[model samples]
Target: MGAARVTRRGFLLGGAALLALPGTALAATAPEIADCAAWGARPNSRVVNVVVQRPVKILVHHTATPNVTDLSRGAADALARGIQNFHMDRRGWLDSGQHFTISRGGFVLEGRHRSLEALRNGRKQVEGAHCTGQNLVSIGIENEGTYMDTEPTGVLWDRLREMCAYICGQYGIAPTEIYGHRDFKDTLCPGDVLYGMLPRLRGEVGGMLGQRLEGSSVRAASWPVLREDDRGPVVEAAQRLLRGAGRTEVAVDGTFSAAMAESVRVFQAEHATEEVNGIIGGESWPLLAAPVQAGDGGEAAEAVETLAATSSTRPPSRVGPEQWQQLLTAAR
Candidate 1:
């Protein structure tokens, strides 16, 4: 109806300038500022004012339901600001509802300034609200979504994995600490399809943490090989994978046999990894094992081969300079 006040150039300038912050180096690359200026705005600007009353223990959230497709790098930043404005201006809240916000395009933005720093110290600090009661001890993360009955984009799922792992590691929060906003309240805020992936979300986060702990990147650690006598974890991993893939009917005995080796070969061929040799060597170790994801409601895990099929996104080898600036600038 009216001319959009924020210009793309303005967002670009804003995005470039954010790289100067102290925490930019540690955080992931942000979306383009120009992108942030274009997304649809939130309704009812009632800002809620509140105090950081307690230490954060977890992050919760719902999809804010902003309808748009073709989300550029900038939309993520725009969503963060819009949401912050909504919570502060519309909801009469002090700041954004969550400490982190993931855009539809998989961009992650910092809502509160001190959140990352506080999380790094693993000390008590106040995070924003997404879930009530738990808000006193949790960091809320609202994605640009309406999860009523829809599946989240692949990008959203990946970004959530990155954010969850980063926060959990920095704050000493476990995967069990991760929960959907509905888990605490009656509202199905995050929606069913997106929420249904919580178990996977937890696993992704756990997979991330395991990588950090194991001295590898997320992708690298997903399938790790045992160097020596650590065959127990590897053997167990292979058996589990074969069983999960429905290729072998092997018992959970911690021994590697020809049948297990054949299963591994089949899995390698399927994943397009090097053709599986009978020997489960270093190259084959990662394939045999499954990384742990945060379990949901105690359902038995789907098995290693199944996990390999599910965990498809690859980790970026190196962080680019321009992308880094975008992420820092998007932090509200």
Candidate 2:
């Protein structure tokens, strides 16, 4: 709606001004990106939220589109336009939900409208809807194709590594900070094959950035985000913890309701400084929960058993040796 906002990296002048200017070397090193206009996106009618803080992490997603044989640039452009249409018309988003996308043909394209300009400047970020809770604070890159079983083509892999390196370098994010969609949500998105490659992806990105990630950082964990209207065994697990924390109003029935929300607020009030929004995340999760194991009993054991009964595909749903403590602290 307005002239491209001036950025700290210099007057953007235009896209062709990517040559490394004095004091703007980092800005010049951004990977080539086709902006929304290049792919014929609709006019973004809604306000796009911008943040001054650099994103702390990169999230990888797969389009879940069929693994088609067409690897042409035209197909990539068409894919971008199709995604934008679906996001705006079907999903009711302002524009595309993700910050960027990489086609199977290795064409890197900007998803959200201003993402390319922001990435070039590296001082601002476009808040996205790519992931539920962490969208405002992280960059999401959707790689085209469902990698549930098959590996991505070598060209696509090379482009992914380059794009990740550029984003990490510009944002000052650690290579180990890269993660898959499933890390924050309870979905098989990005597929098992792609999700499994995250550690190796991190290591390779680290190599490109000259930063070696240790095994611990490589194995870093983030708990699932339980939002409104969502239901699962994990919700039941959290409900048990809420009951132990003295919010008896929360029913351990594997459903997220207003009562469970109220209980979550009270729990946060007691153990955390977070806003009483009833959302459970890293900040409150560790503070409310302690450690639970196979021998552990009481509400904590029941919580673990409930989560353990969740889908067998998810490793966390299993009551393994290192069962995350969900109710021990509250039960105390």
Candidate 3:
């Protein structure tokens, strides 16, 4: 099959350029997707307390269960209801745990009503509870069926790819931005088989956006001097960017490790224009940084501005000095 082509302008609009047969293939803004009305409305829905002062970075998730079934709009609605119940009744969340839900039949349902609203306006708002601290910058998406028992269906793959491309384009997130839930937490939420598609998924999304591979999103940013307090901000930023860049293997715990080192190596090798010494040196640091550039013709610049302002005004309450040191050492 021929590769998909995505335009930078289209990416900025959160649109995807998908290729494939009409029935089997789908694009991000595909009209086939049912509206919120398709899925029953949340009874007594109330606004949540959490404040999202920024846009989303990565889309995290799970398989929900191993119950694979035929793709249908009804099945998708059922999954949405189940999700609403689980999040509200069990998790004590105001709404569903994810921003979107993909049924076995490839039906995509919006979880939080405001989620789509946020995406549409281009304002960076937090989605739902996928990762703990990182949830502030990530959007959680749950896919039906455990890929372990059976491979994801063509519908699911096509839909997921389209959605990923859409989200990436909308937020100026490179294909490297999409991720599995396990990438941040210490759990197998997305399952092994599905997680395995992470790399290729990112590449496919990038292809749709017409962007070359940006390589691993994780790893340490190179800094010549590691001040005691520098680790927290720098490492957290790197972890977030790596996930957004589609290097979903690293944890955002602020601890740099061998895996991070490996990611740095891979990123450098892929870029070719940089040194592949596994160091987040000054030269490599800027490239690894997200929000692209201040004046670049991309959404990355706007995101960078948002992140800088947010981080400066409010420090991440979770990261610690020890974690920062580990991250600094690993990147070096």
Candidate 4:
């Protein structure tokens, strides 16, 4: 859905009024930010209300642009405009795809209109277009510069930490929810150099907030090798994913039972992987978690169909084409 647009004049006026109110000033504890009006963003053709659900995670992305040294407000504004133009005019999105953007010089700007306002109230989030499946559930932050080779500047990193800590505080989200863009998608965004620093980022954010880090709550981006008897939330996650992929018998009891193993074997064989062992390792995790759609053939489609059939009370033969389509859409 498209985002509703706020005129530049209205946005600035609103900002001024908000600033005049108590608790609206950009405090020392909060990162200084530039609203969409500050970046000269055009009004969106369509604006949607902020979704009231609290964000579950923070997804980080890199702009994939050159690491320009200009850290001035003008430069940051220009960069924001460029990104918005690309998303709106080129990508055909209603507004900026991300909720926020940070420049190389450490200037943070609101990406989508009303994003800053939402954060200020700590009430809701502007639905972003950054990540496909996670747009409604997570906050997307795009960092300036390509980080495939070199690391982000010290200033940029520090600002990112502050921003993350502030966001976590505002949303009541945990630091462990921080994730690289590549963690959810196939792209090399937020680049290797930056992505490798996520663990440290999470730790620093946690430290900044004076919160003790909890290992159990963190979601592992990569699946560690899991053989029979391995059990935890990760195992449960795998079971849920497999069940969604069509293993109806695999209960999400967090146990790697024989039935779960057999399901894994069948999945591996269907995918034509070299190893057909019931164990779920690196090879099986990605396939299991990857999205499936209608018209998709091979093992993945079969798995999805199997799950759909089992989820329904009706027999497999009785399930119609529209029902299957609905199942596929829901699975995604």
| Top of the candidates by lDDT | 2
lDDT of 4 by residue, 1-332 (tens): 12333332122232221111122223214667788887799898687559877788898999999999898889999999999999999989999999999999989899999888777656688899998778888889999999989999887898888788777766767789898876555456788789878888887777666655555333233434556887665566567778767887888687888888899999888887646878665456667755555566544445455455545533234324434333432332
Task: Kindly report which residue stretches of model 1 are placed more than 4 angstroms away from their true locations once superposed.
Answer: 1-57, 211-332
Q: What lDDT tens digits, residue by residue, belong to model 2 across residues 58-127?
A: 9999999998789988999999999999999998999999999999999999899888767766878998
Q: Summarize candidate 3's per-residue lDDT along 139-194 as a digit string, tens digits.
A: 67778887654567778888887777666655556556566654443345566577
Worst 10 residues of 4 by lDDT: 14-23
Ranking by lDDT: 2, 4, 3, 1
RMSD (Cα, Å) for all candidates, in order, is: 17.2, 9.3, 15.2, 12.7
Listed per model in order, the count of residue pairs whose N, CA or C atoms clash below 3 Å is 32, 0, 14, 8
TM-score of each: 0.47, 0.66, 0.56, 0.61
Per-residue error (Å), model 2, residue 160: 1.1
- Model 4, residue 262: displacement in angstroms? 29
* lDDT of every model, 2 decimals: 0.50, 0.73, 0.57, 0.71
> In terms of TM-score, how similar is model 3 to the real structure?
0.56
Off by over 4 Å in 4: 1-28, 214-332
Error of 3 at 18 (Å): 10
